[model samples]
Target: MTMPQTITVLALDVDGVLTDGKLYIADNGNVMKTFHAHDGLGISLWQKCGFHIVLISGRNENSVTVRANELGIEHVFQNSKNKIADLQSCIQAIGCTTEQVCFVGDDLGDLSIMNHVGYSIAVQNAATEVKTASDWVTSLPGGEGAVREAIEYLMKANGTWDSSVASMMQEHANQ
Candidate 1:
């Protein structure tokens, strides 16, 4: 539980972990992706709490870049076949270490980073092997608020959940 406070960055895999593991390919070679609003909000909250976010994916998709940019996530490494190496580059750029990172994914491709991170998380839809290697598993499946669930769980562990909620509620009340 205390480990959450030590987490300074979150490295996320895009396809399975963020988009239901499906690729929508149009007949004309167009690609599209759907992302959960809840997950976006969760990322915003995490950033507001002063944490960094990094996006890592094997496919080179414009949609992923757009989404990452929209969320203000600057550490985007798309088409990264070597997630662990890419993550290491990100960590170095951010001046953090493996011990300050939380890696979330749903496939075997993520196993390396999952094993190296301080806290590893897997979506409900993650493969059995991925889940087995994770420190925590989300109740919701990926692309369906699973990222949000993971963020909430971490916030709770870091002793910031109540305060974050109170702050949001107070903001709403003031409005």
Candidate 2:
């Protein structure tokens, strides 16, 4: 297996990646998405380590914006019909090349971006085609600690896992 390059920017899809691919519709006509708290904390940890995080989704959910804001993620593009274009724009805005970016996705919508990035990851519940295209596949299903798994895996590969963990632990201890 080929080893991954150092990744500086982490991009993600929302529905099927951060979610379980199940859209929860409430009786009151409101949409409720269940996000794993572990993933949220992982994103926070990633940011603390100075890696950029971007959320690209084919959805226009308010929850996506809310969640991103909560995580201090500034780059979120929802209702993105063309993920490749959006990803390119994000890369340019961040002044990073495709080789410095890692993308985590689940479905066909995520395929092109995954192919263009330096490292591609698929959640365990991702579609077969998506998984086949990924350089690495997480053991956890999407919206269920999958993002956390991806974060840990990438940090370890980048040789920052221990330091990041220590930083988080120190912060927790101080709290």
Local accuracy by lDDT, each model: 0.88, 0.89
How well is each residue in 1-175 modelled by candidate 2, as lDDT tens digits? 3355488899999998898878888898778888899999999888988899999988788988889988999999998888888988988988988888889999988888888888899999899999999999999999999999999998888788899889889988999
Ten contiguous residues with the weakest lDDT in model 2: 1-10
lDDT of 1 by residue, 62-163 (tens): 899889989999999988878889999889988988998998899998998898889999999999999999988999999999988988887787777788
Provide the lDDT at 50 for model 1: 85
Clashing pairs in 1: none
Residue 2, candidate 1: C-alpha displacement in angstroms: 8.4
TM-score (C-alpha, index-matched) for candidate 2: 0.94
Q: What is the TM-score of each candidate against the true structure?
A: 0.94, 0.94
Worst 10 residues of 1 by lDDT: 1-10
